[model samples]
Target chain A: MDSLGLYVLAAAVLFGVGVYGLIVSEHLMRKLFAINIMGNAIFILLVAASGPVEGAPDPVPQALVLTGIVIAVSATAFALALMVRLYQETGQATLSSRDEGDDG
Target chain B: MTAEALALIVFLPLLAACAAVAFPGRWLGWIVRIGLLPLPVLMLAPTLAVLDQNVIHLALAGHASPLGIEWRLDPLSLLMLWLNVGITVLISLHAGVSFRPDSDRGQRFWPLWLILFASMNALVLSADLFNLYVTLELVTLAAIGLIAVESKPAALRAGMRYLLLALMASLLYLLGVGLIYGQTGTLDLYLIAEQIEPGWLPVTAMALMIVGLLIKSAVFPLHAWLPAAHGNAPGPVSAILSAMVVKVSIYMIWRLWFWGAAGWDLATAANLMGLLGAAAIVYGSLAALVQDRLKMIVAYSTVAQLGYLMLLFPLASTLAFQAASYHLLSHGLAKAAMFLAAANILSSVGTDRLQRLAGVDQRRPLDVFALALGGVSILGLPPSGGFVAKWLFLEAAWHQQAWGWLVLVAAGGLLAAAYLFRVLGVICLHPRKRLNRRQHREIPNLASVAALILAVSAIAAGFFSAPVLSLISAGLPPGVTP
Candidate 1:
């Protein structure tokens, strides 16, 4: 009924969508998109929830969340490169721990 | 030095990262190398000086919090900041010599790495939750970008997996923040901690937030993406990812537990985390022992090392906190050295399989020694930082009369020793001809030196714990028994 309630609902939906995307997505890029969406939702919630301490959305949490988003992207890009190399080497996109023969 | 100097320490690298994109192909490597020049002397020294004093607050543009960016200097932040900058410089320099800039992959790596450093500093100095989040996001983006720098499909898949997990964590964290907002309407961690009551809503908030952080820290079950991401990446990238980036989330959890969510009913959650950490210790070490590839072993070892940080929660003493912080620094150096040593081996042998590295020590003694130093440090052997860290944790647990926690701490050290010695054994005993059959190429001196410096520091931490401990105790809350 209020702004907080609306934000909470939005966060729940965002979380659900992120989970669903993480489960169903096969391509790494699409998964990245889903993850970004999830991060955005979290950022929104953190800022919204801070609730304007002293007539301003608590700047501290907002700054932290912003830093988190950037870190997420950096890590994502690095992982994608690693994935591409893996595919280039082994000719597979999906992760499978199942190997035919044990090295040990 | 003004806050402007501290700001420059973080942003200069970021500016270089952007400038790296603008440079010509041949000059990018030199430009990146030059970019790191000011960091060691300019950024780290003053930070250490600041840490020796009290908390130094810098408001960007002379504006205070809630309206402008702020950089807060504390011992914990200083420790992390120095390590991040120092290691990034070393990694960048190592890459300059070993990495072939002509390769499209190498060109992109430098810029992203600088950005990652900037984000890491921002995260360290961040005073409040929202600021921490923003810097964390910057870190995630650049880290993800670096992972995909290899442009390999597997790396891409790993990146995506990591992204998905990170996203989920953020969302959960957000939900928790939302709940807290509904209850207290403040986001500044200290303020919220002061005003909030120990009710169901706050409890839910705490749980959600901790879980989100746990996912990022990759404690046990949530660590699904770490091995593939770190093990399969390019060598320098793996070093960065394993050595420091992952620790950022753990640091966040530290802030939350001790400062942010101080009075939550943590008995259940602490034990839960401790159990998961214990599982990680045994499972990750066992997993590492059986791994064929060199980097995979180190990657799994990271999972186990991460478990060490969680041990503090169960012990839950000021000494435990200090031990955790100490261990964090020790492990950062040791693991970075291990990864760098592994990279050197990979570059030389053109493969990182354990069996193939039997005679590697004969050819590259410096590298082998570097690896051995890292091994000893990580195993918590005497005179190494890891040993002191383990001792502190055990003492803290003993003081609490928590016998189980002591055993957990000891068991982790033993497991660490087992896996580390396994690698050492393989290095010493195997036939020289097998490794020597491939032509031996001399590793760049800078890489070896970088690894050695870290190894030495890990050992030095044991002797020099006094200053660091005192600095960490500068602004303690009342009743915290350090």
Candidate 2:
């Protein structure tokens, strides 16, 4: 099989695993990791989708993946800050809102 | 000149966001106020360049499409751009008076606020799929930053949920973009439009992208994150989030579908979107009727109003498109006004509970008036922009002989009225318990003034739909033949 086919399959698998983690994990940190895995998976797909030229990587999707990486870093930082604050204010980082009252 | 102005519209806010951090504490408000100086430049400049008989495009870093970033201007972008500018200005006006300059919330709010404005303008102009993805990220990040500014448990938790969902949504969108790239070998929107082959690749790409956008736009079932995020954020944050931020993603969905996917024969997809629109309208309105908190009611109402915009996907005519565009601007104004007015009540009463809002009309008469006027447009009554949009939507549905959409739109409006009046009803009744002075801080005149002007203009916009419609139809985006 071609490199593109392998990349696509890998992206699909990583995305599936990440989605499962997001749904099954109660902890926000685990969820964040799942999201990062999903993000990296897409970046890989983006790079592989371009089809390598004479063994040299195309700059556009690489540039895109680089940009995506920066965005992901900042987003991760912000989400972590939010998780920290939620933990501080309410003393838990779990996603189970049904057990708790909103106004509390 | 127009190109420079368009470029300035996107860049000026980014510069200000960077400058806001350096500009020191007490003068931060002044810096923010100065940051908005370019808005008048944006408003006064005629953004369209059709007079030159040239295809309007701007290449960032002096690079062309496919290999470089690109921005394109058309009537739909201009319409949404104008709406974004107007709503942002009014929201800023309210926010300017809402907090002290050195306060923690104010400090946390300005930079992110400026970034969101820039991101939205960039999103409006971007014509390349990868550039669109970047802009979407910026928009989502800045919105989460704003939502979490309160540092309260509720706001923080809501912000986290919003972040995760928004991240997932964008990843799905990016995957679809990747799939299309695998097929087409390009990310330029118009290029993709011209070359899209009708097949499973396009079909799967469309499904994934649509689901992604639907989740980001908070169309029902995915809407649980919205109320807590919107309702708990401080007033101005909620105002901008509800009014302009959500509309950004929806606008992207429309732009992509119409410009790139319209030729792909999306009959089944379009019908499904129409059904989702119906479900969102009915479900959201019912949920709004049952919400006890004032902001919660407005947040749910936003879900229903978004349904009206989604109707265009199914109807897929020039008139339906125009009606959807008009409704977006009108609903945005009305919702922002309503949220700010709710903020006023929350500020005065120390809580937003329905039971605590007794005699709010008597207490903050102007704010109540603002709320009621905003509700009038939300209900799509005559002599308002909402009414014009509803009438146009009905006409579009009639022409298509889609009798079901006609009933859905009307019923949604009726249900909207039911919930809106429920809040106003509380205002007219006597308070079950008297509010002590601590709970009865006077509502600021500036707050009500901002809300009143926006609400009235939403009504006034009704009378002037002719010019706006002509403008949008006049400059229909490239690849979308009228």
Candidate 3:
């Protein structure tokens, strides 16, 4: 296989690992990490999949990756804030520990 | 001239959001009015342009497609813009009372609300896939933030779950965008449609994007997070979430299937989507029937009503498109009314528990009436917008001779009626003698009036169907023979 195929395969593996971690980890912080990892995997694929223009790496995907990173970072920050607030309110960082009967 | 109007339609609210952060207290209320009130007036230019010329395209930053971003406005997007403006303005009246811009909670609410408004306008106008992703994220984050703004443990928990799911969904959508860009080297939706070849890679990309959108739109099995999130949110927040936020993602799926991937033979996938809609209708209504809380029932109803939009894919005709688009409008109005009324009842009676809400109709007659009026549309009874949409849907199904879908559409309406009447019976009929006047808090009359107006408009939509239906037919997707 060529170098591009190798990179795509690597990104796929990373995405799988992120999804696995997101499911298995109970802590909200861990889930945030898992989401960021998944985002990085997609960023890699986005950059790797696009072919070079005139032997120079295409700039459009790079620009898109930069925007994606900004969005992912802001979303992670917001999620972390929510997680901390949740922990403070419920005395637990994991979502599973909360009782299901609370309606509002 | 149209370009300036389009720019203002998106940027005005964004500018207000910035001002909202800086100017707190009394000035904030005036700022919101200034920011939003002119939006409908501004829409007139674009509406006329679209009416005259079927579709209008504006290339942002003066560069054409495959390079700079493009904004396209057709009948469908024009309709969405009007819905967003109309609903947001009316709901703001309720928010004006509940949040009270002079208060701290109101301060936290208005900025995010305006930002969500701007992002949705941007989302509908955008012709690029990546731009849509950005706007989608903006809408999701703003919505979840609004859900958790109250900081109740329940609201916080619900918002957290929704945030996590939404983030994952965005990543899936982004991955698909990446794959499509790799294949076609263009992020423009129309350009991609023209350039894409039918193959595994493009097909895989479409599937991933659709699944991600399905989760975002809360269709069937993917809808576990919806009831809690919408149920726990503040009244105005829940109204917008159910009315427009979820609908926008479904709109994206429509654009992808009917416009972006128009040439691809998605017959099997379309059938699968229709089956999911059927399941959502059955499961959501049954779940709603057993719900003990008023808001949860309304939230579950949102999940069920969302299923009707999915039926368009399998029917795949001009009539189906019209039905689904009309459903979006009517559901937006009706659901917003129901949520606002539910919020008022909860505030007045101190709880929305169905058992505790006995005799609430005596104290909050207008709110109860609003809830019932909205339910009329939801049940697809005659002379409501929902009836018009459902009639179109049945016609489309009969024309195509799809018996299974035809039966499901009919059954879905009956299920809707069953749950809606169950709520009405409990609230209106199950009366306790001599309710204590001291315990009931009186909500402002304006709040209740806002909900009633929305409910009345949902009914009025049925009467004014001629012009809207004509607009929808004029803008049918590229491949459809309208």
Best by TM-score: 3
Docking class of 3: medium
Order the numbered candidates by lDDT, best leading: 3, 2, 1
Residue range with the least summed lDDT across 10 consecutive positions in model 1 chain B: B473-482
Give model 1's docking category. acceptable
Worst ten-residue run, lDDT, model 2 chain B?
Answer: B46-55
Tens-digit per-residue lDDT, B325-426, candidate 2? 899989999999999999988888788888878867767888889899999999999999999899989988988899999999889889998999889887
Q: Over 4 Å off in model 3, which ranges?
A: A51-54, A100-103
lDDT of 2 at B424: 87
lDDT of 3 by residue, B193-279 (tens): 988988999999988998899899999999999999999999999999999999999999999999999888889989999999999
Between candidates 1 and 2, the one scoring higher on DockQ is 2
Model 1 — TM-score against the truth? 0.88
Q: Kindly list the per-residue Cα lDDT of model 2 for residues A20-90, writing each as its tens digit.
A: 99999989999999999999889988887666646876677777788889988988898888888889988
Residue B92's lDDT within candidate 3 is 91
Per-prediction DockQ: 0.33, 0.58, 0.70
- The DockQ of predicted model 2 stands at 0.58
Of 1 and 3, which scores higher on TM-score?
A: 3
- List the candidate 2 regions with Cα displacement exceeding 4 Å: A1-3, A53-56, A98-104, B46-55, B429-438, B477-482
